[model samples]
Target: MLIDLHVHSDNSPCSCMSVAEILAEARSMGLDGVCVTDHDSLAVLAQIEEGFQPDGLLLLVGMEYSTPQGDYLVYGDVRSLPSGMDAYGLFSAIKERDCAVVAAHPFRAWRPSDIACVTCENVAAIEVRNGRNSLRDDRLAEKHAAINGLPRVAGSDAHCIHELGCFPTRFTVPVTSSSDLVRALKNGQCEPGEAFPLAVGL
Candidate 1:
């Protein structure tokens, strides 16, 4: 199914969409589901409770965090990993808590961390198709994914609706919950895909 694993509502400093906007857009986009991973916050959870009109669009609750190393994608219940910790320290902490840890835009050249740091088993998957990522970043992500025995996942990292499906992940495994999503990621059951549904354009 077409599941977008990363998204941000206006709650994030970089985003402009309200939670309502995100849901409405998800309906318009014909998406099966989306993970609203606002940066370092779970405010979206409240939106779910207040009634998001699921419309069959599963809004998985998660939050993205900026670590000293770079961006960290986290799912499930857990407190912030605290700022200022290096990648290794952050990875160690994630392992201790057993949260699904994914390296966002892992190949961005200017980032503090490198391919070597992300090879650790603590990292659940290497993000290969970040919408905001450049061509160089994409190549590095794929190459690194092959090398480190890590599954390749993608994310639009969308802060806006236009950004939502620009580079989404495609999972053959049915997306039922957060656990299925995580399993698809770790088991390589998903594959990188084009930005949008190919049939729609024709």
Candidate 2:
């Protein structure tokens, strides 16, 4: 299953696209699944009903958790995790729940360096490609992941319609729910690839 592992809907303060807009774009781009990872919150869940599936495209919820080091794409029981925790605290908490955590756009422009944080035992993967990241940023993340022997994933980190699927993670197994995605991520059963060229100035 090809899934955009990180996306922002209207629930995120920086995003402009609504849930419907995101879903339409994902389907049109031929994505098998989309994870709505709103920044620091899962408010987008309100817009998703039980078993929300349209045209066989799976809709899963995650959170782009903010920390002093950088953002992390967190899957599974995000509501149980609190804010203001540092990378170690966040990872430790999520580890106990058997969830997944990926460092999001670690080398993106002005974000703090994530090398140290991503090295933690609890961090499942690192986002090597992001829609909003420059090629240089992606390169840095790629090198870091390679050097650390960490699993790599990708995400749109998309805040708008056009950004969806620019970079997405392809899983070897079916990922029909949040738990399935988390399992895939933790087991290194996925790879990141691009579906379309990113628009200029992303």
Candidate 3:
């Protein structure tokens, strides 16, 4: 299954696209699924059913949680995961619940946190390729993941329709629920992939 695991809908303060528009665009782009990871909120989940799939295109809800350390792409139940905690604390919480966490755009130049600050044991993967990231940022993230022997994932980190599926992760097994997605990520059952026919190289 091909899934774009880092997308933002209008629920995110920074995104301009509505959930309907995001779903339409994902279908048009031939995506198998999209994780709506609105920043600091899971309000998108209220607007859709759990494991929502329209025409077999899944719409899974996650969150792009911001911390003083950096942003994290978090999967699984987030309602009880309180805000204002540092990244390390949040990662510990996620692990205790058997959920999953991925360091998001860790090497991005403008980000405040250092990748080295994120402990490897707590992370399920490193986002090696983000749609909005520069080549240098992605390369550095890739090298970090390689050095750490961590699983790598990718996503469009889309805030608008055009950006969806610019990068996606391919799962080796079928993923029907949020739990399944989390399991796939934690077990290294997925791999990063590029969008079809990119005008420029990834």
Candidate 4:
């Protein structure tokens, strides 16, 4: 299945797309699934479960957690994580829940220390391609993932309509829920897929 493993909705302060709009766009783009990983929040999950259910497009709940070192795309429960937690503490808490962790845009300009965090044992995958990242940034992330022997995934890191489904992680098996995605990552059954060209200024 083709799934965009990182996305954002109106629930995130930085995003302009609503959850309904995101799902509609994903379906139109022929995506099988998308993970709604709003920045530092999973409040949109409830909104998804309550009102949005489109056939042929799976909506998985997740979050982009901020740590002092960088950001992580986290799946499964995040109730144990506290704001401003450091990388090691964040990894330990997520590991306790057996959640899936993908280093989010590790080579993005704002977080130079992300390479160190991505090398940690608890990070299951690294985002080798992010739609909004520069080519050099994506290549650096890819190189780090290769050196660390970690599985690679991709995401749009989308916060708007045009960015959804532009980058996705393709799974060997169908994954319909957050748990299924976790299992896929744990078993190394996923890989980075195609990404749209980066915008002019992004």
Candidate number with greatest lDDT:
3
lDDT by residue (106-199, candidate 2, tens digit) is 8887553377788747588888988877889889989998898888898887888888878889899888777888888888889886556654
TM-score per candidate, in order? 0.84, 0.92, 0.93, 0.90
Model 4 stretches with alpha carbons more than 4 Å out: 50-52, 79-82, 196-202
TM-score, cand. 2 vs. native: 0.92
Q: On residues 1-202, what C-alpha lDDT tens digit does candidate 1 reach at each position? A: 7777788888898898787777777757767778888877777766674212548777777667766667778765444556566667877777665367777887676442345668757677888877777878888888888877788788888877677766667788887777667666667788776677522332
- Residue-by-residue lDDT tens digits, candidate 4, 1-202: 8888888999999899998798667877868888888888868857767212556788778878887887888886654566677778888887778588888887788743378677648788888888878899989988888888989898888888888888888999978666778889977899987654533345
List the pairs of residues colliding in candidate 1: none
What local distance difference test score does each model get? 0.72, 0.81, 0.82, 0.79
- What does the lDDT come to for candidate 4? 0.79
- Candidate no. 4 TM-score: 0.90
lDDT of 2 at 96: 77
Worst 10 residues of 4 by lDDT: 193-202
In model 3, which regions exceed 4 Å deviation?
A: 198-202
lDDT of 3 by residue, 1-202 (tens): 8999989999988889898888667776878888989889888877777565657788888888888888888887776788888888887789677478988998886552358664568788889888888889889888888889889999898887777788989899999888899999888999897565651564
Residue pairs in collision within model 3: none
